[model samples]
Target: MADQVKLHGNWLSPFSSRVIWALKLKGIPYEYVEENVADKSALLLHYNPVYKKIPVLVHSGKPICESMIILDYIDETWPENPLLPSDPFERATARFWIKFIEDKSPVLWGVFLADGEDDREKARKATLEVLQTLEERAFGDEKFFGGDEINMVDLAYGMLARWMPVIEEVVGVKLLDPDMFPRLHALAENFRQAAVIRDNLPDHDQMVPLFKIRREQLLQIAGK
Candidate 1:
């Protein structure tokens, strides 16, 4: 049996993409069930009763919620092209950076959703500080966070490669400057060129207009 592997996810969510990339990298055969966030499926609700979020992986009637957790499960179950390092310390380091992005990615999103000049500026500064630190610390000299191979860290932080540009367009701000964030720029280019990622990524053209609409809704709610 192939364990009846299936994933519930939304097309635009980077969290969902993380699981997709991890599964694809490991050559896992699975089904992707696209979820409507507005009207979540009963199966998703039952599987993830707490958060009711997507990117839930169901295997052999066992449901695994949360994107990173699903990625870990994928790594353990498949075990061919591993996503985490075998060495304990290296594994911890990869987990560390993944957690870092998971915790700090919100600052960037807050900036994107922010309205009013002062608030947006504050959020922008915070986002810049986080990006600056990541540039120097995580990506300073490594080709990828896992070094030469895309790993959990690279997949976790991949939102910066695609969605940041979408956010930049929606917010009408330039955060990923080639001069200031050269390392990030190069990383984004590399991620875009990756075989699995290149083929599987969502269409930016379709997403841009949708995100533009989302941006306007956020702005209107914020009274901009």
Candidate 2:
């Protein structure tokens, strides 16, 4: 039988887009299963009972969970177009940056979800601190985290390029100011300009309305 590959993901979720970009970059043909995150499907639950999240990569009969983990699995399974670095030290460095962004990502989300102005300001400051670390340490003069071409590190931090804008718009903040984060601003523009990512990105205007609604809903549920 031919190899069977399927991705269970939500269109709006950057985590889902990470796997999608990796698969596309590697030229891996697979079926995409759109997930309803609000009311998750039983299949998604079955595939990932621990996190019960989207962006599950089902290869043949096996299921793989977590966005970054799924990306690694896809990289190893289909090695035609390598995502990580060829050198051992370089690959480890890439992994380290990936983990750093993954850990700090929730801080950005805190700004989006914060109810009051005081809370949002605190979250935003922390977000800037995290971005400063990425700007100073994780990234350099390279066009991409992967150097010239986009790679797994770029995909891991895809939110900085794509979703951060939408989040900023919906939340009413200038999070990635050009003057403040010039390198990241340029990085965001470059990452989005890439053909694969540009074509696959969720519509910005479309996301604004949806995320605005979601932000309100989240606040309401939290009794904010």
Backbone atom clashes (below 3 Å) for every candidate: 0, 0
Give the alpha carbon lDDT tens digit for every residue of 1-224 in model 1. 34998999999999999999998898878888999987999999999999999989999889999999898888888889989889999898888888898999789797788888999899999999988988888854667656788888889988988899888887889898889988888888888788999888888888899998877887898788
Instruction: Give the least accurate 10-residue stretch of model 2, judged by summed lDDT.
Output: 131-140
RMSD of each: 1.5, 1.0
TM-score of each: 0.95, 0.97
Model 2: per-residue Cα lDDT over 140-188, one tens digit each: 7889877888999999989988789999999899888889888988988
Write out the backbone clash pairs for model 2: none
Q: Which candidate leads in TM-score?
A: 2
lDDT of each: 0.87, 0.90
